[model samples]
Target: MKAAQCSDYTSTNTYESVLTVQESVPTPNLEYDTPPAGFKNPMLVRVLSVALAPGDVRVMTGDTRELQGPPSMPYTPGGDVCGVVVEMPKESKKKGGWSFGVGDRIAARFVNKPMGMLGEYALVSPDVCDKVPESISNDAAAALVSSAAVAVIISDYIKEGDRVLIYGAGGGVGSHLCQAVRLKGASYVVGVGKDAKRLKSKPISCDESVNYTKDDAFNNKEWQDKPFDVVVDLVGGIWPKLVDQNQSEKSIVKSANQGGRYLTTTPDSAIFQGRSVWQILRVFLFPALWRATYTRIGFSRSYRPQYSYVIGLPSTSDIVTRTLSLAEEGKLIPCIDDSGPFPFTTEGVRDAFRLQASRHAKGKIIIKVSEK
Candidate 1:
C-alpha cells in the first residue's frame, strides 16, 4: 500500500523530515485493531479525502510528545477521513450498533492513534463514522466532520438569543462554530480575527467582525456597549492582545453578560508552538493551573463566569450525524480556504502541514487521498 508516514519527529524542519510517502507499508488488519471490549466496530475504508488539522501539525512538530508520551512509529497523522467502506463484518456493525453497509460514502474522525486517514486505506471505528450525503462533496464532507463535531458539542452550552463572540472566527473550525451558534438563535454573532477580509469572506452570517490588528478593537466602544453573553475562543492566550491595553482586564469583565460562559479549545502551549522547555512545561501545567484551588476560587469570586477548555470527543455519533445532515441541507457552509484540495502525494501532504502550521488559513485544508 502506498501512503504517507510520519516516520520520525523533527525539532526544526518538522514536516520536511517527519513525513514521506512509502510504497510498501502493510495495509491495516481490520480484525487486529478492534478492541476485545467489543465496543468499537472496525470498517476498512478506501480513503478518498482527509483534512489537515492543527493537531496534525502539532504531532508532526513533536510538541505533543514532550508533554504526553510519543506516538507509535511510522504513524499516519490525520483525524478526519471521507472514504468508501470496502469491508465490514456484520458482527462488527452489530457490536458497534451502527447500520451502515459496505460501499457507503462516509466520513469519520478517528481516535488519536497511529493509524490515520492520509493513506490509501484506513480502519475507522463505527462510533466516529457518519454516512455522508450525496449532496455534499467529498472535500466538504471530509472537512466538516471534526469541526462540526466540536461545534455541535460546544453548542450544548449556547442558549437562545445569546450574544456570542467567537475568537479566530475566520478559521475553519470557528466558521462552522459561527453557523452552529447562529442556528441556535444567537441574537448577534461577532467574529474577531487579525484579517477582517478573511473574517467576512464566507456568508456565515457573523453580524459583526473585528480586525484585532486595528487599534483597540476589542475595547472599542461599539463592542463594549454591546457586551456578549458567550465567548467561544478558538484562538487561545492571544485574546489579551486584541483588547484595549489599559482596560484589558476590565474590558473583558464588562464585555460579557453576568454569568457569561467562556469556552476555548486550545488550552495548552501547543498553540504557542512549544518553543522552549518553559513553554513545554506550560503545556502540561496549564490544565493543572485551571484546576488549582486558588485559581478556581479567584475566578469564581471575581469573574463570576464559567471558563471551560473544550476537547472534541469522537464518540459523539449523534453530533456527527446531525452535522452531516446540516451540511447536506446547505445550512452549514464550511469555510475551506481558497487554496483548494491537496493532491495525495508527499509534496501535497507536506504543503498541507505547512498551511496548517501557518495558523491563518480561512478554511479547512483538505487532502484528496484517492480519486472517486
Candidate 2:
C-alpha cells in the first residue's frame, strides 16, 4: 500500500516523506479489479488522495513551510480520500470499509490515523465511509474534505439572519463558508482574505469582499463602524477591534465561542499535540457559557448590543450536504478551480500536489481516485 508518512510525527516542525509502496511480507496475492458494489477492498484500483499539509500556511504547526514535494522520499501527505472501492473487506458484508463490493464509485472521510489515501489504493477503515451523493462530483467531493468540512463546522453555530464576517475567506474553508452561509439566511455574509481572482471567480453569498492587501483591508472606510453578528476568523495574529459604538454592547465574536476554534471533533495533529487543549475545551464548555451570556445580556441593563459572536463547533453535514444539493439543483455553484480526467496516475498525484503548493492556487484542488 502507498502512503505519505509524517517524519515530523513527534517534532514541532511538520515534514512528511514518501517511502516506496511498502511491500509486506507474506503479502496476500491481492488481485487487481473493482469492488462488487462501490467499495474496493483487497483489490487494486486506481485512486488519488490528498496528502497532508499542503498550503500557504500550516495550522497549529505554526509558521508556514514552503509547499514543496520531497524528491522521491516521503510520498504524498494524503490521508483524506475520494476514490473507487475496488474490493470489499473479507470480514463481513454489512461491515466493510466500503459501500460497494467492487467496481463501485464512492467517497470516504478517512480517520487519518492507521492509514492514508495518497496513491492508487489504500487499506482503510470502512466505518467512516459516506456514499458520495450522486449530486456531488468527485472533484467537489474531494474538495469537500478539510476546508469544506471546517466551513460546515463553523457555520453550524450561527443563527439564521445573523450578519457574519469571515477571515481567511478566500482559501478552501473560507470559500466553502462563503458559499455555505447562503443556506443559513445570513443577513450579510462578508468575506475577507487574499487571492483576488478567486474572490471574484464565484458569486459567493458574502455581500462584500475586501482584499487584505489593499490599504487596511478590513479596517478601510467601508467598515469603520460596522458591527458584525458573527465573526468566523481564520486569519490569526494581529487584529484591530471594530464595533459599532452606538450599540454599546460589543457583539464582535470569532469562533472564539471556544477560543478561536470550530474543529473540536476532528482529531488532527494539533489535538494530539495538546497545543489546542484549551481550544477544544472551549468547544465543549462554550455552549453553556454562551447560553448564560445570552440570557444575562438579554435581561441585563448593559445589553444595548452591536452584533457578533464567536462560533466554533462541528457542523452537521447538513449545510455542506444542502449546498451540494443546491449545486445539483443549479441554485448554487462551486467555483471550479480545476477538475479532471477522473482518477489520476501516481505521477499525476505528484504533479497535482506541486501545483497545489503554489500559493496562488484556488478552489478545491483534487486528484481523482477513480472514474466517476
Q: Point to the candidate with the largest TM-score.
A: 1
- Candidate 2 local lDDT, 207-284, one digit each (tens): 777677773444444443455655565554222233233244333443233222222222212122223646544543
lDDT (CA) per prediction: 0.71, 0.47
Error of 2 at 148 (Å): 2.5
**Residue 175 C-alpha lDDT in model 1:** 74
Cα error, candidate 1, residue 311 (Å): 2.0
Highest-lDDT candidate: 1
Weakest 10 consecutive residues of candidate 2 by summed lDDT: 261-270
How far is 69's C-alpha from truth in model 2 (Å)? 18
Q: In every candidate, how many clashes are there?
A: 0, 37
Off by over 4 Å in 2: 1-76, 91-101, 112-115, 201-205, 221-224, 238-327, 335-360, 369-372
Q: Which runs of model 1 end up more than 4 angstroms from their true locations?
A: 32-40, 66-71, 93-96, 238-257, 272-304
TM-score, candidate 1, is 0.85
Please give me the total number of clashing residue pairs in predicted model 1: 0
